[model samples]
Target: MARWEEIENEAPEFAARVRSLFEAGTNKTIATLRKDGSPRISAIEAQFEDGEITFGMMQDSLKLRDLRRDPRLAMHCPTLEPPKENPESGPGDAKLAGLAVEVPAPPDTPHVGAGFFRVDIREVALTYVGTPADHLVIESWHTETGYRRKTRA
Candidate 1:
């Protein structure tokens, strides 16, 4: 992770939209590699908090097992229409980060994946497209813990 001193800041409205949309329901595509170099994919429901987005699932599931070996992971939370296919394709300025800590299995649920994963959003890229021509493009960063602006300068 880079030092706090050097980071880009995101606009308030952008952050707010992310927070709101995530709350409703976004398809999270978690990509991981298998032992034989095969690809493993899982689509899951993700919830976003002030600091991180959480995913709950079974402990004995395939995804959790894959995560144990390869910590390096990439996840895409896409916002789509009711069908939940073909994401709306909004601004790419989404705060993203790699997650490490995976919570222990939940007692009642008895699910191995019934826990939360935190993403310390390092930065986001915003792409603006309109009728005439693409004009606005911005990259910003935020504090790892909460969605606080790190590029406010």
Candidate 2:
């Protein structure tokens, strides 16, 4: 697994696109594992800074308990429809799969006893659709393989 900064260093363009989607909005969706091993989806806000991706949880939140037990997670950027005026206006939707590691909160953090976690990326992907041709495009990056892309009609 690699940090966001390492991905940026190894694959600048791919990293930039992923960063753009994360920066385009403050809200994203995350999936985590429930106690019984089922999936749980929740809305979350993440930060990409200082070479890492981090997110916080409210004190004693169920999500925090879930993360404490199982750190595996998948995050998807907000979905955006294609622009009517220009087909190329939308970059794409981004997704990331990673493990969350609990971290110490900064002294200035407002949420007392809140859980703070950093993402250790295992895979990252961008999906592009609704273009003029209506083809589906998927670009993916992995820790070992670097980057790969595919398109389908």
Candidate 3:
């Protein structure tokens, strides 16, 4: 398996983009099921560092209680949420898409761990199909496992 430092440190361009994406501090909405089987969701800050994703949960938050009973969690981030997008987009493509090349074949990233129990990115899919001007291009990034901040290095 490729070490986190090897991938992030050896490839400066890739490293730069990863840092930027995580640093962008895009809203991380985490949804987890409670012990009673109810749904719990919240918006918080998520970051990729060292070798995993990190998130903070307050002591009094219901999320914290749920985790104690059921540690599983999920995180969601969309490069292009809308099925149909306008020609005039935003400032950039998040640039994060470029770095997604870290994967060669499908499910390219195999070593994903429970690094974000605070949140998890379970799957990723990409699509680029449409007209020339108003074409729809979608590149999704995701992971399955999750972990907590304090426990991860």
- Evaluated at residue 146, the lDDT of candidate 1 is 36
Estimate, for each residue in 64-100, the C-alpha lDDT of model 2 and write its tens digit. 8899999999998877777767755677899999999
Best prediction by lDDT: 2
TM-score sort, best first: 2, 1, 3
Model 3 earns a TM-score of 0.47
| Cα lDDT tens digits for candidate 3, 1-153 | 222344444444544444454465577556667888987877756666556455555545776666666666554443443344643333223322111111122255343331223223233222334344345455433332211111111
Better of 1 and 2 by TM-score: 2
TM-score per candidate: 0.58, 0.92, 0.47
The CA root-mean-square deviation of candidate 2, after full C-alpha superposition on the true structure, stands at 1.7
Runs off by more than 4 Å, candidate 2 = 84-88, 130-132
Highest TM-score model number: 2
Residue 81, candidate 2: alpha-carbon lDDT: 73
Instruction: Rank candidates, lDDT, best first.
Output: 2, 1, 3
Give residue 115's error in model 3 in angstroms.
13
Candidate 1 backbone collisions, by pair: 8-141, 9-151, 57-113, 59-112, 93-125
102 in model 1: Cα distance from truth in Å? 1.2
